[model samples]
Target: MKILFVNNGLAGGGVEKLLNDMLPLINESGNYCELLILFDDDAKYLESLRNNGVKVQIVPKKIYNKGHFQRILYIMNYIKNNDFDIVHANEFPLIYYCSIIKTILGKKMPKLVMTEHNTDNRRRHIKLSRPLEKLIYRNYDKVTSISDKVQEVLLDWLRPNDRDKYVVVYNGIAAENFRNSKPYERSDLVPEISEKDKLLCVIGSLTEQKNYFLC
Candidate 1:
């Protein structure tokens, strides 16, 4: 299978590191792994892929900060020229582009997969951008929420039929990669978390309505 990975940059963020960690296992499965990073930030992971003999491509410039419609053309052009069996986006912003604009490149666009990494309710952008999301997300073949809470939040807003399109795919850690690569644990580097007496936990942002704070 030819899989194309879309990310905003090659920064050492959670999503970026996760993809790099999983690349070896996935490539060993005989899938062609191609990376299409919108940002040209450092390309820190580029050498890792090349060293492993995996095929990677970086665009000349990032179109991420550009307006949505403009990014549509840039992404669509890229997808049109690339023959990929699947296109998966790790972030929600890219998810919008993949599901909406990527479909216009061909009658049968690549199977679209989006992984929701954050709490759905925490997303302030979505409430205001519901119309845009409804149009684009309809084009996605699959939508994965990383946790049950995210799935529930999505269900409340999504149509009943659209519920079937979303699945709860738990986020994970690459055990083998952790054993081999000396990557820094996020919480360890952050000063707030205690290394000896506690476990690191993720918390979503508080939501504010027209007059009240919810959750």
Candidate 2:
């Protein structure tokens, strides 16, 4: 299938990491995967995707918000010009755009899919004072959550009656990449730490969802 994976940007995040993991499998299976991202950045993730034969495009954004109409137009036009079987949105903003396109264009639109990467995020605070979230989500061909907990959280918010529209799809890890990673000394981060003392470490974005407070 010719799938266009849509996300906000090529940042070192869970969503980008998941795509990096899946690109090899997708390419090996003879399925083409393209990337559509908003904003331009000098991220190495772009080179990785290009090296794996994934086409990447930078869609211009006039506003910082994900649900901006200008970005929606760019996405709509790109899909309309391309022959894609699926348009998979990896974030809430892209999901909302795809949903709108599917709802408006119907049969003319590509198969819309969305993946919810986090159980709790900023999307819940959309104070648009509208009741069209469920209606928008219904337009998607399929909705996936990274885990069962994420699915439960999404369903509780969307309140979709069919229930079957949502599914659990665990994110994959690129195990081989870690095999040759250079180990860092604990003293590099902590001047008071001794080399003999074992230290606990945490990785990933230090956001609220990461729950660093628990540690």
- Stretches > 4 Å off in candidate 1: 62-70, 120-126, 177-215
- Please give, for residues 69-153, the per-residue lDDT of candidate 1 as tens digits: 7776777787778887988887756887787765565566888888776554345456766666667777778888878987786
lDDT of each: 0.71, 0.81
Error of 2 at 76 (Å): 1.2
Root mean square deviation (Cα) for candidate 1: 6.0
Candidate 2 regions off by >4 Å?
60-67, 126-130, 178-192, 195-198
Best model per TM-score: 2
TM per candidate comes to: 0.73, 0.84
| Candidate 2, 1-215: lDDT as tens digits | 99988888877877877787787679788888888888657555888888887888987545435548877877888999999999999776777888987877779998888988887766567845125777778888899888899899888887788798789988877678798999876777888988688786777777888788888
Native-referenced Cα lDDT, model 2: 0.81
